[model samples]
Target: MIGDMHPGDILGEYHEEVIQLYGLGPRKVLVTEREAPYPDGRLIVSRTDTDGIITHVNRSFVEMSGYTEAELVGAPHSILRHPDMPRAAFKDLWETIEAGKIWQGYVKNLRKDGGFYWVKATVIPNVRNGEIVGYTSVRRKPDRRKVEECIPLYASMKAKEEEEVAQ
Candidate 1:
C-alpha cells in the first residue's frame, strides 16, 4: 500500500520542472490525434493520497502511462492530465469524490512521450477509520463508441473553459 506523505517530500527538485511542464504549456496542447495502443483484458490501477499524489500503481498502469514506477510513485496524479481533457470534467470529478461518492467518467490522459489515451475511469474514495484517507482509481479501455461520443462533448467543455478563462 502507498502511504500518504507531503508533496514536498516527494517532489523535491522535480517540483519546478513538473510545474513548468504541466502548467506553463498552453491550456490545450494538442500533440497528436493518434490514440495510444493497449492490449485487451488489462486494467490500470493507481492510488493517491488525500492531496492526489500517487502512492502506488500496478504494472498495467505503469505500462499504459509510459512512466516508470520510480517516476510516478511520488508525483501528483495530475501529471497524467491530458491537455485535451476539459477542466470541467476534473471539476466534476473532484466534487464527486470529495463528497464521498464514486466518480465514473471517460478520461483522456497524456503519455510520457506526449501521446494520448482514453480510459473509462472510476475513482473511489479510500476511507479508513471513518476518515477519507485518499483515493483509488481503476481504469479500463473505454468503448470506442463511448469515446467517440465523448470527443465532441469534451471539446465543447474545453471551449467553455477557455471562454471562461478568457473573460
Candidate 2:
C-alpha cells in the first residue's frame, strides 16, 4: 500500500531553488509524481553523523533510494527529502532525536530518478560517552490506511509552513 506505484510519471520536469530546508542547501532538483513501489518485507536503514551526513547505508536503503552506496555515504540524509513534506515534520524529528529520543513517523521519500516512495521511519540517536555521536534510522513499509490519514495532515502542516514563510 505504501509503496504502490502511482500514475505520476515524469509528466512534467522543471527546476526551482529550494532554500527552506534546514540542512540541504539551495539547489535545483527533478520533481515527479511517479511512485516507486516499496519492496515489501525489506527494511531500509542508514546511519548519519551528528551533522546529518550519511556514514553508512544498508543495501535496502541503496536500492530504495535509487542511489548507490557510494552515492549515499557521506551525503546528507536529507538528500532524499521530498519538497511536499512539511518542514515542521523534520523540525520535530530533529528536535526529538537531538534530545536523545527515538522519532518515528511516516515519511515521503524522493528517489534519485525523480520518483517517490513512502516509509514508516524510526530514528534514534547514537550516543556514547554521554554525548550524541550520530543517528540511525530504520524504515519499513507503512500501512496504506495510515498513509492516507497522513496525507491531509501533512498538507495542512505544509500550508501553515507556506503561510509562515509568506509573512
Best by lDDT: 2
Per-residue C-alpha lDDT of model 2 across residues 23-138, encoded as one tens digit per residue: 44454556676888888889999999998999999999998888778878887888788877898899999999999999999999988767789999999999899999999999
Residue pair clashes in candidate 2: 3-38
Worst 10 residues of 1 by lDDT: 11-20
Clash counts for the predictions, in order: 0, 1
What is the alpha-carbon lDDT for the whole of candidate 2? Answer: 0.82
The local lDDT score (0 to 100) that residue 109 gets in candidate 2 is: 92
- Scored by Cα lDDT, where does model 1 land? 0.76
Model 2 weakest lDDT span, ten residues long:
1-10
The Cα RMSD in angstroms, rounded to one decimal, for candidate 1 relative to the true structure is 7.5
Models, CA RMSD each: 7.5, 5.6
Could you give me the TM-score of model 1 versus the true structure?
Answer: 0.82
